[model samples]
Target: MNKQIALHPDLDDDLLDVMEPDNGGSVSDELSRNLRALWSTFYRNRLLIAAIVGVFMLIGLGVTMLMTPKYRATTSIQIDQQSTNVLGNTDQNSVDPAAAWQDADRFLQTQVDVLQSRAMAITVMQDLNLNANDDFIHQMGGKPADRPAGPLSLADTKREQILNVLSDGLRVDLPRNSRVADISFTSPDPRLAARVANAFAADFMIFNMKRKFGSSTYARNFLESQLSDTRSKLEQSERALLDYARSAQLLDVSGGIASSTDGSTTGTPRSLTTSNLVQINDAYAQAQAARVQAQQHWEQAAATPPMQLQEVLTNPAVMQLAQLKAQAQAAYQQDLQRHKPDYPQMQQAAAHIAELDRQLNSLATSIRGSIKEQYATALKQEQALSGQVNGLKSSTQNEQSRSVEYNILKRAVDTNRTMYDSLLQRYAEVSAQAGVAANNISQVDVADTPDKPVSPKPLINLALAMILGMMAAAGFVLLRDKFDDSVRTPEDVNSKLGLTFLNSTPMLDQEMTPDEALSDPRSALSEAYSALRTSIELSHKGGAPRTLAVTSTRQSEGKSTSAFAIARNFAKIGRSVVLIDGDLRKPSLHRLANVPNGRGFSNLLARMGSIDEAIQPTETPNLSLISAGPLPPNPAELLSGARLPELINELAERFDVVVIDAPPVLGLADTVLIGSTTEATLFVVEANGSHHGHAKTAVRRLTGNGITIIGALLTKYDARKIGYGYGYGYNYTYSYSYGQPDAPSSSRKWPWSKK
Candidate 1:
C-alpha cells in the first residue's frame, strides 16, 4: 500500500508534474538555434556558397564519368559451429577429448577464417582459370610473363600473382550478432564475379562435409569394439543384481514379492507394519477432530451467562417458569394501575410473580449441570485417542529400524538396472549415427548474377558532395566573421564598446570629385554627414558643444575627413564653423584643399604669425580652414604652449562653432592637449577597421584628462559586409550613389593588409 500525501487539498497534482524542465524540449530548442545561425550565414554568402557547391558537384560528375565501375556478386552461407554432433565420443579410451568440436567463439571465428584463407583463394583462382587472363594478371600489378626475381620458379611466382588477384577482388562481410556471412567478389566482368563467389561457398561446404564424414568413419570403428564390451558388462551387472535380490528375499525377478508356501506375511515387514500404523493414525485423527468439535461446543456454553445460554433458554421447565413469571408480572402491573397497594388483588399478583422467579432459577441450574457432563465426556475421548496415536508412532519407528538392510539390497538392484538401460540407449544412438554423415554448415543463398555495377552511385555521391561542400564553405564564412575584429556596424561602436552612435559615413567612388560627393545635399555622403552634424549638435544635454575636438585612436581612420565633413555640414546649415588641422606631423587638410601650408597654425602658435592670416576661407558658405603651419621641429612642444588655449578661445569667438581636427589620440599628446582646452571631444571609429580595445582606451584617455566625450562616430560602414541587409534599410552603394549606381571598394583602414 502506498501512502498518499496532499500538498494542497484543492490543488491538482498534475500542476506540480508540469514544473520540471523537459530535456526533449531543450534539445529541440538548441537544434533550432544552430540551424537558424547556419541559415543566416549561408544567406549572407549565397553567391559564394553556390560557387563552391557547384565546383564540388562538377568534380563528383567527373569522378563518376572517368572512374572505372566495378560489379559485386555476393554469396551467403550459415556456419553453425554450435550444432556439433552429439554422439561424437569424448571418452579417454575412445577419442582424445581435447580434439572434441565445441560451439565456442573460437570455433565460429575459425570457420570464417577458412572462408577468407589464401588456400581458398588458390582454389577459386584455379577454378576460374584466371592465370590465362592477361587482364587479371595486369590488375595485380604485373605482366603475364613477369615474375619476381628471386630463388623461386616462374610457375611459383605466377601462382602467387593469381592468388593476389583473387584476394584483392574478394570482399568478405560479417554482419554483427549473426553466424551468417557474405562472400562477395568484385570485377570488371559481372559474370566472373558471380562465378567466383558461388565457387567459394560451394568449396567451403564440401570441405566441411568431408570433416563430418571422417568423424563418422572414426566413430563407426570405435563404437563396434566398445558395444561388445558394454553388452557383456550389462549382462554381468544384471546377473549380480538378481542373485542379491533372491538371497535377501526382498525382491522377485517376476515383478512380485517372494512368498513362503504356507502364505505367511512376507513381502516387506516394514511396509506391512507401516500400513497398520497408517490405519491407526487415520482413526486417531478422526477421534481428535470429533473431540475438538465437542470441546468447542462446551466452551461456548460455559462461557455464556445462564440467562443468555441457548440450552438454558430452550429448556421446557425454564420456558414454562419464565412464561408464568411474565404473566404474573403483567397481572401485578395491571393491579398497580387500577387499585391501591393494600388491595387484595395487588398482593396476590406480587406473590405469584415471586414464586415463578424461584422456579426459573432452579431450572437454569439443572441445564448448566447437564452441559458440564457433556464437556467431561468429550475431553476423556480426546485423551484416549492421543494415547493410541503415540503407541502406534513408537511401533512404526521400530519397524523402520529392522528394514535398513533390506532397503540397501533393493537400492543396489535399482541402480544397476538404471545404468544398464542408459548404456543401451546411448549405444543405439551412436550405432545409427555411424551409418549416416550429417553436417551443421549449409549454403543458404547462392551468389546471384548482378544486373548493374555497385560502385559509382552518382546520385548519392552528388548529394553528399553538396552537403559537405556547403558545410566547408559555411565554416569558412563563419570563421572569417569570428576572426575579423574591425567594427563593421554601428552596434560595434555603441553597444560593444559602450558609447553613443553618431553616424556611419559612406565611401564614394574614387573617380568622383570630393566636392560633389561631400557637399551635394541629396547624395548619401552628404546626407550621412548631415545626420552626423545633427547628432553632434544633440550631444550636449543642454545644447550643442561650442568648441569640440575631433580625433581618432590611430591614423587613416578618416578622423580629419570626418571633422571637415561635420564643419561643412554645419556651414550648410548657416553656422560659421572654423576647421583647424592640429596634426603638425602629417597635415592632410592643406593637401586636400590645394591651399598653401607655409604659414598656418605652427607660425601662429610660435608667435610669428597673425591668427587672421593663418585662417583661410572654404568653398562652403560659413566654413574656414586653418591648415597645420609648416611642420614644426617640435610639434608636441608647440601645441603644449599656453597660447594654444588662447588661440582656440579667439577662434571660438570669431566663429559660431570651432571644429579642430586634432591628431590621433593614441601614442600622441596632441589630441589630449587640444581636447583639454575644448568644450568637448568626438572620437572617430572606422567601421570594421578600428579595434574595439583601441576605441575604448581612447575614450578613457580623453575622459581621464577632464575632457568631455560627447560620443563616437562610425565611419566607412558597409551594410552588406556585416549581414545587415534586411535589418538595415540601405546598402553601401545605394546609400552613397550620386545619380549613378556602382558598388565601391571599402575605404576603411586595412591595417593587416598594409605594408
Candidate 2:
C-alpha cells in the first residue's frame, strides 16, 4: 500500500544535485571552499575583530603619548689610513692600491673600534667633566655617587658610573671604502647630546696626535740612547787603536788611514820605516845612475878613448883644448915639411905649436883627473844610500808584523764611527720631525644641537598598532573556527560527516510549538520540512521509501519534532502518513501530535496490543500516530524481537508513508533496531547542538546495523549563530498577513527574522 510521490516538474534539478552527497574534490576546490568558510567566519565575527582592533589602537596611542623623547646628535670625522708624511716619503705612496685599500679598511675599522672604546669614552668624559657634573649625570639616567664603600673610593666609583653612562649613549659607524666615521650621542637635552658628540670627535683626534707624538718621542729617546752608546764605543775604539800603535812602535807616516765604503778599514796608517825606505831607495837609484856615467867617462879617458865619451865630447873646455891642439899639429906639420926642427921662421910656428901641445896635455890630464874624482864620489854616495835602504827595509818588514792587531783595532774604530754618524743623523731627523704635527685624523664637521627629538612618533606607532591588532584578530577568529566542529550548514553536512544534505529547518520561536508551526502552511519550518520531504522522495529510485525512521544522536535535538513535521507535511500533500513513536525509552510523538500515549509501537512489539488498536488518528487530514504505550523495563529486548519488523511491515501496508519517531541512536540500541525494520532512516542533527563526532558515530551505528540512511536534516538552524555564506539565503521570515493571498511575500522584511 506504499505509494511513491512523483517528482514535481517545477523542482530544480541543479539544486537537487547540489544537495546530494559530495565525493572528494580537487585541491583547488577544497582550498576555495576553505577560503569561503574563513571569510564567512570572519564576517560573522566582524564586531569582535573591530573591538579588539580598537582596543589595541587605543593602547598604542596612549603609549606613544606617554613616552619620553630623546635627542640625537652626530659628528663626522675623517680617519686616514696613514698619517701625513711631512717629509714626503715615497715608500708610502708606492703601496699597491688593493693592498692600500685593504690596509685602509682595517685601519678605518680599528678607528671605529677605538672611538667606541672605554678608554676613549673616559677621555671624552674627562674633557667634558661629565663625571663631576651631577645634573648631567642625572639627566643621562645615572644616580649621583654615594660615599666611599668597600674597595672603591667615591671618586673611583663615580668615574666608573659615569664611564658606563658614556658607553651606553655612544655609537660609532664607519662606511665601506670610506675614511669618514660618524660619532653619535643620545640624550634628553639637545645641547648635552651635541656637546658629547663633539667632545668625542675632538678627543679622538687629539688622542691620535698624542699617540703619534709619543711614538716620535720614543724614537728620539731611543736614538739618543744609541747615540750615546756609539759615542762611547767610537772613543773606546780610537783609544785602543792609538794604544796598539804606540805599544807596537808602528808609527804612521801617513797621518790618517783610509776607509772603504763598507765601513771597514783598508789598512793601518803607513809606518815611518816603510816611508823612509821608499825615499832612500829612490835616491840610491839616482845615485847609481850618476856613478855609472862618471865611471864611463873616466874609463874612456884612461883607455885613451876619453874623447869618445859623451861627456868628454860635449865638454866645452875639452873641445877648446882639442881644437888648439889640432891647430898646433897643423902648423908643426907644415914646418916639418919645409925644414928640420929648429928653423928660424918655422921656429916661431913650431914654438906656437909646442906651446899649444904643452897646454893641451896639461888640460887633458886635469880633465881626466876631475872625471875620476867625480866617479869615486858618486860611487861612495851610492854605497851610502844603498846601506840606508837596506836598513829601512828590515825595519819596515818588522813593523808590518805588528800592524795586524793595529788593523783590527782600526776597523773597530771605523765601524763605531760609522754607526755613530748614522745615529747622530737619525737623531737630528727625528728631532726635526718631532715638532711637525702631521695628524691624519681630523674633524670634518662639528655636531650641532638638534632642533627636533627623534622618538615617540605617533603615525608610526599607530600603523604598527593596526598591523598587530589585525594579526591578533585573525589568529583569534581562526582558532575559534578551528575548534568549533558543529554541523551548521549544507557544506558542513558534506565536509564534516560526508552525508547527503536534505534541507535545513529554521529554529522556531519559543512561543510557537511544533504542532502550531506545522499547522501553518506558510511557516518557514513547514517549508524546510517540505523541501526535506522532496529530497527524501527523490532520494529513492522509485520515489519516497515506503517506511522511514527519524532519529538523532542526542535527546531534545528536535528529532520527534522533525518526525512529526515530516509526517504532517506528507499528509498535507494528500499522502496517508502514519507517525510511530519508536522510542521505547522516551516517546515524544504523542506529545508533539497532542494525543495520548496509552498504547503505541512498544506495546505491539511486546505482544500486548494489536496494530489496529495502536493506530490513532491525528488532527491533520491524512496523518495518524502510534505512541509508546508505557515505559518498558527492557525496551532493547522488545525492539530486538521479530515483532518490530512485522509491525513496521504492517504499518507500511496501512499507510502510504510510514514515519518512525525513533529515540537517540548514541547510547541505545532501540533506534537502530527500529530503523533496521524501516525502509530507510533520516538522520536529524541540531545545528550548533550535536557534536560532529557524536552525529557521525550515530550515523555509523545505524548504517552498521544494516539500516538504510537516506540523508541528514539539520534542525534548529540559526544563520546568525553560524556563518551565512554557503549560498544559503539571508535570514528572512515568512510574512503572512491576515486575509491576504496565501502566497508568501517577496518584499516584506525584518532584521531579526530567519529563513
Question: What lDDT tens digits, residue by residue, belong to model 2 across residues 354-396?
Answer: 7876675666667677888999999999999988988888888
Give the winner by TM-score. 2
Residue 212 displacement (Å), model 1: 13
Candidate 1 positional error at 355, Å = 99
Candidate 1 similarity to native, TM-score: 0.46
Clashing pairs in 1: 486-688, 487-688
Q: Over the stretch 1-755, how does candidate 1's per-residue lDDT look in tens digits?
A: 01111211101111121223334455776685456445555666788889988988888888888767778999998876434444555542332233345445566678888888998887777776776657676543346756664876887787776787788888877776787889898876787788889999888876776554433455556565666666676566556645654564433323323345696434443344455566777877877787778778778877887777898888787888888888888778777989987788887777778777777777776787777777777778778867877887886676555455655544554555566566667766655575233566788888888999987799988998888788877887889656645565554565456666666666555555556666566555666676667666655666568898889989998888888888887787788888898888898888665677878888888998898888887777788889998898988899899999999999898888998889998889888889999998888888767764777777788888888887787776655454554334233333334344444445432211112
Stretches off by above 4 angstroms in model 1 are: 1-69, 74-184, 187-192, 200-453, 456-466, 494-499, 553-557, 572-576, 586-599, 609-624, 653-656, 665-668, 688-709, 721-723, 731-755
- Model 1, residue 514: displacement in angstroms? 3.1
RMSD values for the candidates in order, in angstroms, are 31.0, 44.6
